[model samples]
Structures are given as C-alpha cells and as structure tokens.
Target: MYTIKYRVPESARSGQSARSEEKWYHVSILTQYTCTSTGASNKKRLHRKQYCIATTKSSQLENLRSEFGLPVVMDPIGNGNCQFAAVSYHLRQYGIHRSEETLRQEVVTFLRQTPVLGNRICGANWWTSILKQPRNNLSRMSTEYEYGDQITLQAMSQLNNMQILIVSTRNSATTLISPDGSSCLSSRYPLIILGHYPEGAGEHYVALGYKRHALERIVDKSAQVTWETDPPTSDDDLNVGGDDLSAGGDNLSAGGDDLNAGGDNLSAGGDDLSAGDDDLSAGGDDLNAGGDDLSAGGDDLNAGGDDLSAGGDDLNAGGDYLSAGGDDLSAGGDDLNAGGDDLSAGGDELSAGGDDLNAGGDDLSAGGDDLNAGGDDLSAGGDDLSAGGDDLNAGNYDLSAGGDDLNADGDDLNACDLGSPNTSDITRLREMVQFKRNRKHVHQNRHVILPREIWCIIVDIVLKLSPLSRYSLQRVNRMFRDLVGKTPPPRLYLCPSRFGDVTVSPISVRKIIALSGSGSGLVQAIRQLIRHSSWVNAWLFLRLATLCGWYTVEGIWYRRKRRN
Candidate 1:
C-alpha cells in the first residue's frame, strides 16, 4: 500500500484567521502503488468531509470551526470516506517527453476530461489485469488507475466519506450510482464528442481537448496573413483580463491550451540558450508580446521556417496572434521547429496546420483551415510545436485538426504555452526576488552598502529598462545603491552612446513623448499613459507667446521662476 500527503501552506487557506497560511489537510493523493485484485488485498482508507442537503449541517460545521479553524467549514458530515482500486498504478518514473509540462498538462487534461470515477466494490472482489502503468521502463512515480476496480467500488461504498461533484453523470435519471462495478465518466468533456457506448465495454478515458469527428473549418483569405509579429504587453496583466476566465472559472478548458512533456527540461524555451541554462538568459525562444499589438509576438524571427515560429528548436516559439481562446487557436504550436520546432495546431474553429515550421526550405504555411489529419497547425495557443511533422512513432511535432474520426495519434504530445513569464519564467522571477531578499539580510544599514558583485551583473541585465520598472525593482533592497548613480554600472558606458545625442534632456523626454503621441496610434498610447498617471506630477510646460492679459502675466511669472 502507498500514499501521498500534502500540507497546504498556511498561505493557501481561505480563512480570515492564520488558517489562510495553514492548510494541512489538502487533497489525499494515492500515489506510488498500483495493485491488481483477485480478492481483497492491502486495504486502505480515504477521508474527506461530505456535504448534503441539510441546514443543521452548517451548525455542525460551525461547531467544528474551532476544531480545525478552517474558513469554509464542511457541512452535514465531516471526513467522508471512500476506497480505490486494489492497485496504486505503476508508481514508477518513466522518462516522459522532455518538457515536464507535457506530463503535467497531460495529467491535467485526463483529469479534466473524466473528472469523476464513482463506483463501489464490496466485501470481496477479484481482478487480473494491470494494463498501462505510469512507468514504462520501471521506476517509482509511475502507477496506473483503472476505471472500475473492486477497490474503487468499495471505496465509493463508504457514502459518508465521498462526494462526487459531478461535472457530468451517467444514468442521471437515477441520481445515485450503486453498482459494485465500474462507472466510467459518462459525459463528454468540452470540445470532446464521444460515440455511443458498446453493450458493456465500460468507460474509456481520453486526454482529448479537441472534439471528436468535428468538422474542419475553412477560414477567409484576409485572416491569412503570411506571418507577422505582434507585441502587445499589458502594463498590468493580473488586473486586465476578464475575471471569470481565470483558473477557477471554466475550470476545465479543452483540458489544455498548455502542455509539458517531461525531460527536455523546458526550463527555458530558447534553442541554443534554453531557459534552463541561465535563469537570466536573454535568448528569447518564445517572444514576449504582452499580447500587445505587433511589437513582437512569438513569431520567432528565423530565416524561413513557417507555420508556428519562424525558426528555433523550441516549442510554441512563433506566430503573431495565437490565442488560448479555444484549443482550436494555436498556443505553443511553434515550440519544436522540426520544420525545425514543434508546431501542432489542433485548436477549434481556427485550424491552420503547420505553416511556420522553420523549414527555411519553403515559406511553410498551414494554409488557412488546411485540414491535414494529424498535420501541423500554424494556429492555436499552447499548441506551438515548430518542428516539421515527424512520424507518429517518433513523436510528431505538430498535429493540426483531427479527421472526421477524431482520434489523436495515441503517442503524440501537444504542448500549450503556460502564459506570461511561462513556468520557467516564473521560476526566474522567484529566483530574482529571493536574491534581492537575501542580499538585504547580509547587507543591513550603512552609509553605502555595496551589493555583491553578482548583484552588479544582475542590475546590468536590467539597465535597458525604463525608469518605470527599474524604479520598482530598485526599492527591492539596499543592494540597488550602485545601480543609479553611486556605483554606476561600468557597462553603462559600454551602452551605444554618441556625442551628437547630448540633446537627450528633460525637454527631449517631452518631445519624444509628444512625437510618439502625435498623428499615429503610438502617440495616442503615450497620451493615455500620461493622462491616467496619478503618480508623477511632472510635465513639460510648453510656453507659447503671451496671448492676452492673463497669458502675459503668467508668462512673466514663468520667466521669473525660470531665471531664478
């Protein structure tokens, strides 16, 4: 028998008390073990509070509020229990695809598709099959989960401990499931369309984010821009996008817009300079656009490769307007540019297969709606797999929309870019923040504390930044002393400087701002920033000729102050 236990951080609790920072009883995960059953063997207990229709339940919950001090109290019952299949699954590790995200997204996709497996087993049960284990070669961390094992049946039998928030159900007419066998997820996940069931073949699980037998879409010519760049970054992302579309709402997207295969350590998206190399590498594989308008999208500029990214040996590294709107939209479809990266499209409505494959061979294009069964897609978010379509046996890079039969190649892996500062980027951010925090601990108060030499290198990395973000980072620690003036980065002198550019002054700042805000949309954007800024009161006082009485007096006063 095996088990998995996780203590939710106190920081994760939703209660008003310190509970927020102390969540211990997180989800119970049965990892590490997978057993087959002929008769009862290695029995285990599963526990969690269950809720049912009852007002008295709230009172009971409130009473226990002091017992655990949890914010959202369980009602009616406390600690409901259930059982599972006799086996723990092949709890062994298998070298999954290079990117860990592939495995992560795969598991998430499977979970999202068939979220619940509720069936009950009895006092006695037996089985002899342990089909696909999580582990292939054999190691820990790889186990298998069977649909209806007597163990799971028995587990579900303890009604008081289990709760199935049914995303979908079988035999809905009869509310409660009371079979001592298997009740595979009966409904279809979003975008997935399953055929009718055979007499008694039980439920078949699929990590399908795309609908089955869905019709291929035909897009218009105008939308078919050969390939361009897009650079739309939000000044504040967390606060801009729609609230309901967050991780909580529509909790189950086609299961992905993101995927990660194990191994290749997707720590970085760059080809020559993978993010894994230097957490601070500037070699951008996946272009950062902030979803802004055409400044620079993921369309990795290569000599030729088309479809997803232009060129690069990473996934989801190209395309200008990839959206996670639908699995149909190209997400990370440009990562493996086999053409040279991975470019697997397979989004809904927007099915444009393998166009930007870094093929430098041809101006690779998935031609709008060019339906190639399992072909690459130049479209979709989290779908970039820039490589040219390799053989299915060899892990094909890009697989555009499926066919009328809707059956994804069993072994294929489709990656989805995890949004901004991708997972690896997040790790980098955390590292930077920690570095600053640590520097503070070592260097307390002093007239001038010299940040470690390493910090000097770190600060230099960000010198190109505008005062806006730089100012924010400076306040992070006393280590920022040498950054601005004191210990000016020697690299500052290395920056491209010219004698003729001595004109760059506060007035130049105003002119640049004004010029950018003129006739073009670029100028308007700057104006918007200035108008909305409630912080800096600084502005250029453009003094025109004194018009009349008031103007003449104001001009005279301005001249006095200027002279002083």
Candidate 2:
C-alpha cells in the first residue's frame, strides 16, 4: 500500500500568505472498517461487493492490515514526507549543522511573514467510488436526503474544519456534512454531515508533482493530451511495476483513487484537487471533503466517488458537454448528477423533472433540484436547481444557474439570461423572466447595454429605488455597470415617482447620468446621494420623514412591488 505526504522546503519569496497546500496521494492498501448497523450500506466499504454487509473505514483499514499483515502504514499527519530527516542533511551540506536553532527560527519567521498566508494551501479529500458501499437506496425506511437542504461549499463553509461529501449510490444520491464542524455525519440530519467512512482521512495532504512515467503517460495519451514520458513502460506491463515501487517506474501516487489512470485523484493542499477522470460514464465522489477545486471526478469510472454516469442509464451529455441522462427511476424519485463540464447550480435549489441535479460543470440542464456554488468558482445546476435560501455566486464569468434563485454572491450577476442563443434553461417557476430581463436590461437605461428584451424587468426594479440607492447600485459590479450601462433598464419599469426623486428636475437626471459613469461595487459615488437626499428630507419633509426615507435605502422600489 502507498500513501501521499507533504514536506516544507527551506526557501524564500515573501508575500501576504502562509500555510502551503499539500496534495492528497492515493496509497491503496487493504480496506478495513467498523461495522455499523449500516455497514455494507456505508458506501465507504461497498466496493468490497459484499451484500448485506455493514462496516466502517476503521474496520476496512483493519481488514487490510490483517490481510497484508503489514504493521506500518503511511500517515499524512506525521512527520510528512520525512522532510525533517533532510534538515541535518541540509546543514551538513552547508556546514551549518551547529546552527539548528537558527534554522528553526528562520522557518518560523518564514511562516509568519507576509509570504506565509494563513495556510492558503490545505489538503482537500480523497475520491472514492460511490459504489464502494451498497448505495443507501432511496427505499430504506430511514432515508437521508431532504428537500431545501443542499451541499454547497458555501453552506459547507459554515462547516469549517470538517469533512463532507455529496455522492450517488446504486441509484441514490445525497450530500452530507458535519453540522457541528466536526467530521462526522448524522444519519438523522443527513444535512448535518454524511457521516464518516471511518478510514476517510483526517489529515492534510501536501501536493508533490505527479509521477510522470508509466501510468500518467498512458492516461494523458488516452485523453489526447501530449506529455513527455520518462522511462515509460508499455501498456502490456501493468504487472511489471504495479506493486513494486523499486521496479524503477515512476508511480502515480495520488493514491486512494487513480486520477492519472482513471481512478480516484487525491486531494492536495492549496485547494488543488487531484481528480480522477470524470466523464459521461463515470463520476467522482469525495470520501472526505475540504476547500476549493473541492469536488470533481475520479480518474477511473467513479474513482473520484462522483460516479459521472447513472450506470449506463442512458446518454447523459445533452450537447452541453456537462449534461447527461441519468434515470432516477424511483417513482416520484429522481436521478441526480453533480459533476460534469460547465455544470452549475448558481447556488440555488435546482430540480429536474426527475428530482435533483447537482453539477460542477456548466452550460447544462437537469431535471432534479440543482444548486451550483462553492465560493469563487462554485457551479451547481440542473433543470430546477434552486438557490432557494442559499448562495448562488459565480466567482467569475460564463456561469449560468438554469433553474432558479439565480443570484450573485460577490460578482454582479445575470439571472436567467438563458433566452439567448447560447444559454441554459431558466426553469424556476418554469419561466424565464430573469433570463430575459438580464439579457435586455442592459439597454433601456441611459448609456446602457441592450442585448435582449427581458432585461426591462431589472431596469424596472432599479428605477423604483431611491436615487441614492440607484447610485449605490453601480458599486455592485464593474461588469454589471458596464453591461447595464449599455442596456438601460425599461423606463416604465418603476413608477419613477416611487423614489419621488428618481425623475428629479432636469439637471438631476444629468447628474445621475454622470454618476452612473463613475462607479462599481458597494455604494460607489452614489453613496453620497444618501447624504444629499437626507438633508433634503430634513429641510422639506422633516427628520422623521428623512429617517423613513433612509430606512428604504436598500431600494425605494423594494418598499413597493414594481409596476406591471
């Protein structure tokens, strides 16, 4: 069996950061575990293919120790990579062994300086097959997954210092997290945590470079990617250096699942996820979970524990590269897929005609509830994906939340801009209002963008807000400002009189036009409008009225619904 570890290097380059990241390497050993009432059903040990069996990772790991009769196993938490051993080596080489304390202080200084950002790199988790356990079928009397609750890195973010997972089994899918921020799942509140697979790692991984020879070479070749193969071996030699590390072949060690060779890709620090190959046929699942590049697929079919395909249910890729058909045939039930290219939830609850669809890919469609989000780069989508009560953010561009609750966490957002030539479905209420409004709202306003006709709705909403609010709106985003600037909102959207000052005297309009030209994000220059408007209210309507107006600062229109 093998294990992946990380080591710190004595070095330079200081910036505002600390804590480097480690890579999760797969060190395949025998499986061991503790039997729970749901042992065989654990999904953690299902790969054993033992039916009616129930066990835990602790049990599985033990079982392996017994089978192989090996006493030492690799530990990521221990003196990682034996790097400490090289300290003396370094001293001997530089003739400074006498200054050990100096070296230690130097290392500590490095960790604290601006260069050491607060552990910017942290190991993610290992990817395992979803089928490792008897997928807790949806039929079990005691069910887990529920409605309204989803697995989002953001939602899970509140689960700090914990491990979580979103997986599909036999024909069931669910997301589990440690509610208390402890790494255990509560079968009762499946939402709390998916529980632990026992043997699932509790340590961090440091990323080392991948083994560039035999295995990785072949895997890369299969994907049509070019790479230089060092001391490569032919395909017929799987057994040549398979178990023999000393056989002189560079091995792919992101161990638990094989990523380079279609297995589980290991997790490394720095939020760098080493994923297996996720495709229409297979997906990846995080046996354990952590930060960024948080979830994807495995190398081999389902190696990452995110089984991409629904067991050949049908062709899943819906021409979106991220969409595929997975039949969740349980009556009133659904098939859910969470990983694929360009798939996302827009951080909302997305449900398909079927049931749930969680995706990491984009430009896709689903029939189940979908939620695409994971701080700066999280994408969750599906036919009815709903960011209902959660975050729907696109840390960057070209992100679409096809179902509902399309939102913007930090970036100015485009909700349901799906009616265009190249967008996904705006399935919330099965309508595309936001989709259209986002497309067209860019043009109606003065100096704005005009792409489609639907944007008028947003323009309508923005128009109803107080002038100060409207001005502050520019600070929401540079892109939104740029786009909305091109496509002005519809003039009739708001009653214009709602804000009383929305259509102030002639000179005010020009001032607003000019203000619109100057800002992006959080109250920009328009924030000063609050001060100006407040004084006007004080002089005309009196202090109480001014306070009343200030209270509506979120948007004057928000106080009353926009006109039809």
Which candidate tops lDDT? 2
lDDT of each: 0.26, 0.31
Model 1: lDDT to the true structure: 0.26
How would you encode candidate 2's per-residue C-alpha lDDT over 1-564 as one tens digit per residue?
Answer: 576563433345597455566654454421232233356575655555444232333564454332222221321112221222122122222222322223333333332332212223542211121232222311221121111122222222231222233221211222323333333222211111121111233222111211225224233333222222333354322222122111012233332554352221122321222223221221355432243333344433333433334334332233222333442222112323343323444543345433354433333443233433212122222223444443333323223444444432222244534444223343332233334434444543548554422353365355455443444556777644542343222121112234344323222322333444435322343344344543322211111112222322222221233798
Tell me the TM-score of each prediction against the true structure.
0.16, 0.17
In candidate 1, what residue range of length 10 has the lowest lDDT sum?
Answer: 549-558
Q: What are the per-residue Cα lDDT tens digits for candidate 1 across 1-564?
A: 433354443543465555433332323332222223212242211112243222233564443332222222112111111011101110011111121112223333333332233332332222223344423212211132212322232232222111111111122211112222222211110111111112253232111111111111110111221111221132122111111112211221222233333221221221121112222211254322222222124344332333333232333334544434222333354332223233343432223343221221223333332323233222322233233432221232232322111112221322232232113332333234334434554554435544344454466565544323344555676656434322122110101222123213222324434444345543443344334343223332222222211110010001123563
- Clash counts for the predictions, in order: 140, 152
Model 2 alpha-carbon drift over 4 Å, by segment:
1-269, 272-307, 310-348, 351-436, 439-564
Candidate 1 regions with alpha-carbon error over 4 angstroms = 1-55, 73-309, 312-564
RMSD of each: 32.3, 30.1
What's the true lDDT of residue 368 in model 1? 33
